[model samples]
Target: MSANGLPTDRLGGNYFKLFGASTISNLGDGIGIIAYPWLASAVTRNPLLIALVAVVQRLPWLLFSLPAGVITDRYDRRTLMVIANSIRAVLTLGVALIVLGKQGVLPSPDDIDAGAVIGTDGFLYGMVLVATMLMGFAEVIYDNSAQTFMPAIVHKGNLEKANGRLWSIEQVANTFMGPPLGALLLIVAFSVPFFVDAATFVVSAALIALIPATKRSAKQTDLVERRPWQVELKEGFSWLWSHDLLRPMAIILGLLNMLGTLSGATLVLFAQEVLRTEPYEFALLESGGAIGGIIGGWSASRIARKIGSGPSLYLTLLLGGLTTFLIGFARNWIFVWAMFAIFMFFAVLWNVITVSLRQSIIPNELLGRVNSVYRFFAWGMMPIGAALGGLTVVLTDAFASRDIALRMPFFVAGVLSVALFFFAAPKLTTERIEAARTGSG
Candidate 1:
């Protein structure tokens, strides 16, 4: 199916080029999660420090995402992506070099190698944070621009099918290949996956360069007519404000986003303290979720085609929440693996369905801006959720009971998803969705 929300004649043409680049970029992202955290944790065993790493990575979106979105709407998405990719490549290579030097694997840095690990007397943590922020800033720009660019490349009728394919590939890269392979490379060299990420960014940039669209012309724009950044930011939110299709889905996903964060942050604790699993075994258990996501991705397009996107989301999301709720009661290895797999499957379903709907309804002219606004909200609350989970353990007897601390986050995450389901269902109907898709086409 084409990516324009129309019926699929077939899936081919220029859109495939974007998919190729996305595959490479996504793999790097998945691998980054493993490599980055492991490197940081290797340096500092403190849970707070590990959590701080996540904070550094995600904080950029909350701060500058709106401006990044406006740029995507106002400029050449393809070119912005090229710049983002190139910059990411440089950062990844620099980090890789430093880590290699620290490990004494680089052989010849001599005096420089001594300064590599704790560079600038631990100032590199801040530098790493800054780089993470820039990388995230660029991510918001690239993601927004890509949303705008996708519909332009393919027909309107097949947005769901096309998005499904992309989601499937992302699931494979993220859940399947990223973690396991990253662990293997970490065994070989601490910075090996980062080096791979650097290479992928270069390749992604090259693939993005292959698209036929010309650079956006600044001369054609009316600079004086542009609204203030604050006003423009509000304008983007307002676009989704009165909409029938996107508004409800956004709220539903927003709650899940929060829940996902809480559940994710506490998962390692559950594995380590509750399940008594070895570190490597915990890694294997974690990968089970990704593997489940792969299965869900494989089936998602078929499910959506049979039941429709809105309905599929409605159903799978319920499953996702239930899975979260079930996490608290988990007792043994069997249950841990089962809950993880179930959680991953439903999460993948949620991702695939929502993306299809957004691509189908959002106007191409406003696509980048609207998506940026969506992301800023949908992703912005994750840090808060993480903090809340931490606090919940601190304030209550949750941690003392061990099980309470370990399981409460899961229950909260699940209930949040369930609560949002009712709020979303009445607003999201198959009829409205089909109409939106038809109108867009």
Candidate 2:
């Protein structure tokens, strides 16, 4: 049986193990979403610093993603996943311990607006930053391995189904259930959520280790091993570049990610300052996106089938742009939650189709390398976006009110996303999708 209660034969028993591992890990990530920013906010009220914490977490994608791809291709992906999760467990435990030690001094959610605990100490912030960086490093390998690992366990036709289920569970774990749990944990004790997350990673790693080994080619591994890393890296880059649809998609996604992060990086401050969200309310705000993600995940295949994949993909860009643009104008937290939900809904839809397409299109031998290269471009922009988010607020603060400065990133991202729609719509035609589907690309 599987998550959806379908027979294991449809997706394979190994996929179920993968799904379980993803659920546990995503739950930990959900907790971190609350725990890291909450801890950061407790340390300082500087929007730039808050955003920098977010930046460091994503920085590994830029620095290590390509190499991660190479390793994913060469190794047993299951082993890599287990190792990555184990390391995450340790790093998260360190964070938990630090939080436990410092609970007496850390600020409550109420003190965030009062400026009482602001700029108190750098030691705790530095510790949080280091832990975040290490955890992110592990995530790079774990996520890369997980993506490549999926195609091995499920048949090509079931890629969409598998991805949809995986994404659905992850959203539920990370966003829906995780945030509220984090909020409650924070109310009880700051250290509790981190400790709970550490335990989840341990369980996640164990689940992954239980997965049976899938096939890998010794000849292919030898071929990759024989080549210089530069050559292997080039092969991945060249493959993506030569593919007309994938090339443009990666470029556009990279741009969108940069712009998206630009707005998203300062969300903690926006929620605190502009929306006036308390700790529990802030957690609920996080859950709003998860609600949409859950719906999108379940309906993705159906919607794509009804609308056609090209239009479905186009809809993501159009709706995501419009919703994000609207978020900039929101004065109320309820409005913010609504817009975030809508944006995430489209985002998940985009992910379901695109991820399945990539898995189905890329050859097994080259999947890891090509996927990594694609992410190197696609996700590599996140750190830059995170920095831009913080800078936009800080620089804009010189002239504008703090609230207005916080809104700048959302406005910029929205405008760029809308502009991208016109450029992408024509290029992302059904004919091109068919061409890729038929391997004509």
Candidate 3:
């Protein structure tokens, strides 16, 4: 038995189930993540349209995240996970059917090159946009439920280890295995990848359903569901906003996400024009990050123990700045890939620390709502940043060449991340992290 008075075997067993479910779901996400933009690029070459697809997909974070959080706290988390995956499964199959119908009219996936499609059907573009939006909405619910669910399953002291394993497995599946396979599937048939994606979600839902029920806090039984959601929502917001450590972290994370998306929203174009990669090569580019993520996931806990959480955040920002700056000017595919690897390594380390910290600090009953509110600040800026990327291109089109304009967002992202690093590193001291850990902040 562990110190928490549960059998160590049972805890490990349950976490393995959760890890299995998450790994399968993210594996599917990795495939779809590649397929969606690939399909969008096929349907339209306009940078703004591509950005619009990204924007629409992320818009759910702005619209549904807070409410989703409340729903997560109010309902059975496992049930929510099942429902979210089921929604994704159905929607993804729908997209596959659409793609299958266009097999003759659409260019063969293998025949297409990296650059923009010459002309694409308007109807197809609309379908891609709508499908992506719906999938993103489902993802919002699933992710929030999944994150909050972690605390219920794992012992508090093991949060970092559990998180590291989860993050590493997710990265390996999403970036390392999924994308390259997706590119290969695309080579065989455009619709095949989507069908596989749909199947994975179905399997993931089943896996989640198999996880044993976790104990809920006694405090929750007294607070009936009939109470107003707004009251709880306000409590969540207040909790996050008032926390000295979480508030600054959330704000800085929000800015970083926005900046990251500004460049990421137009990555397909950059891969094509700057790196001059083919479909398979483009997928391989992501593998660099996957490799780095594996290392980061394994090392994050140890690094935090050595340097502390505050310094870990600082390191993430510094690495992120270096990544963006190099990618902005990198003409060689090798150079770009190396930079991506470095960036993702640190990104995973940062996630491990931050996620564990939140899981450790928040009261279980409030976890769902507060996690949602935190994401509202951190992720809400993604759509805005995506829009900024497209807008940057449009605004600069007249003054500079298309390639240069497309590259501008990367440079801007780099500059902003570096500036924030300087501002935040000083404010988020080691003392603050230690205070939060002790519940004294």
Q: By descending TM-score, how would the candidates be arranged?
A: 3, 2, 1
Tens-digit per-residue lDDT, 1-441, candidate 3? 566565544357777888988888778877876787778877777889989988998999999999888888888898899999999999999999999998677765454562434686799999988988898899889999999988777878788988998899999999888888888888888898899999999999998999876665566654444568888888889999999889988888889999999989989878877777777888888889898999999899999989888888898998898799779898877888899899999999889988889999998888999999999999999999999988887788779998798888899899889998998897677788888988887
TM-score of model 2 (CA atoms): 0.96
User: Worst lDDT window (10 residues) for model 1?
Assistant: 106-115
TM-score of each: 0.84, 0.96, 0.97
Question: Per-residue alpha-carbon lDDT of model 2 for 259-374, expressed as tens digits?
Answer: 88999998988988888888778888888899899889989999988888889889888888888888889888888888878988889998988888889898877888899988
Per-prediction backbone clash count: 13, 0, 0
TM-score of 3: 0.97
Model 2 whole-model lDDT (C-alpha atoms): 0.87
At residue 122, give the lDDT of candidate 2.
90
**lDDT tens digits by residue: candidate 1, 107-226:** 221222122342122544554556666777677677777776776665666665677677778767765677667767776777688899889889999999998764443532542156
Off by over 4 Å in 3: 2-11, 109-111, 114-117
Give the lowest summed-lDDT range of ten residues in model 2.
Answer: 1-10
